[model samples]
Target: MSTDSMERTLERTRRRFIRRQRTQRWLRWRAILAVAVALLLVAGAVWTVFFSSLLAVQAVDVEGTSLLSPAQVRSAAAITPGDPLARVDLARIEGRLMALAPVKDVEVTREWPDRILIVVSERVAVAAVPVGSGFKGIDADGVLFRDFAAQPKNLPLIVLPDDIGQDAMKEGADVIAALPTELQARIDHVEVESVDGISLVLDDEKVVVWGSAERSADKARVLDALLNAAPRASTYDVSAPGQPTTSD
Candidate 1:
């Protein structure tokens, strides 16, 4: 081969190698630039969420509140305004709200941007018990929650001895809960002397002897049948549900 031909071929190979190196360098820098941009974007987002005022708490919204007012719930939550919403401890807020007497359960959540939401489940009153001149509400779990200046007309009165234990109150609550709705409406008060001694007093002053919480459904059924068969009877005994009796 001629020397000029060989030189031209070598020059073409060297130029090709230089072009390849340039392309590879450009690609490496492009990837680094992309990674740097992504990191900056992530850092900016973190700053906005954790330090900037744009995502700070400005309001606290309370929902699912009936027994407690919104202000009451917010007070219990104790979330400070202007704090970063992303930094709010939802579990701690929930624990604080659960300390309230009427609050059965609560959920705390971030509503994004500027608000915190607190959803509460309040205890429902199943009965009332005398306390001083007022009455205290009792839930189905026999937990005393709220107080009323006077006895609530809709809830049955639970008459328990001053020294009665929680078990007696629970038994009385169970007996009331087991009664059919029709019979429940007729109830005026529940007399609980002990866990095993529970009775229902109807509006007409008639007594339904319900011995204990055991077999409460059976007792309720038997009492319903007895009332239908002899509506005018004064005393209905269904403690032993299999053998019910009624006396005038």
Candidate 2:
């Protein structure tokens, strides 16, 4: 081969090598750029799920509170501000709220990205029992929750022995609750001897033998009929509602 032909062949080989190098460098940079972009996208998703302010709790909404103020319910929940709403433990917050004496039921939930909602149902007092010089309020479910300096006027007084168990107190409360509103308003107090033995005394000192909590609706009906028939009875017995008796 001539020298000029050899030089031209060498020049063609050098150009081909340079082209290959440029292509490899471009591919390597593209791969690195793709990896960096993927890492950035994953990091952004993680921050949104676990650390972003847009997804953090900004407000706590409380509802169904009467006896307990909103502040009291919020204090019981104890959820920290700016915590991730998706990661909030609803069951833990509900358990905390239930620890309050008057709370009957509670529901906790997350409201989208920025809020948590708490709903509470509080127990209501149906009767009052003497505790030393003051009184303790008892709900219809027989939970003695509140202590008052004075006896509340509308609620009936519960009279049970000092050694009386919760079952007997619940029985007496059930008896009072079964009565009609008019009859309930007339009740001055309730007496419990045992779970199966319950009684009611009216405001005028008229006595009723209500027996156990069972068959209460029947007893209430019979007692209402008996009282209406004999308006001035001093004693009413409806333990056997089918054969009720009234006596002076």
Which candidate number maximizes lDDT?
A: 1
**Per-model TM-score on C-alpha atoms:** 0.87, 0.78
User: What global local distance difference test value does model 1 have?
Assistant: 0.91
What are the runs in model 1 whose C-alpha is more than 4 Å off? 228-234, 246-248
* Candidate 2 lDDT score relative to the true structure: 0.89
Please report, in order, the local distance difference test score of every candidate based on alpha carbons.
Answer: 0.91, 0.89
For residue 181, what is the lDDT in candidate 1? 85
Where is the poorest 10-residue window by lDDT in model 1?
173-182
Clashes of 2: 0
- Tens digits of per-residue lDDT for model 2, 100-210: 998989999889879999988889888899988999988878888888889898888888889888888898888877778998888888888999888899998999998
Cα shift from native, residue 185, model 1 (Å)? 3.7
lDDT of 1 by residue, 1-248 (tens): 99999999999999999999999999999999999999999999999999999999999999999889999999888999999999999999999999999999988889987999888999998899998899999987778899999999888899988898988888888887777788889999999999889999999999988999999988888888898899999999988999998999
Please identify model 2 stretches exceeding 4 Å from their true place: 1-43, 230-233
Which 10 consecutive residues of model 2 have the lowest summed lDDT?
A: 171-180
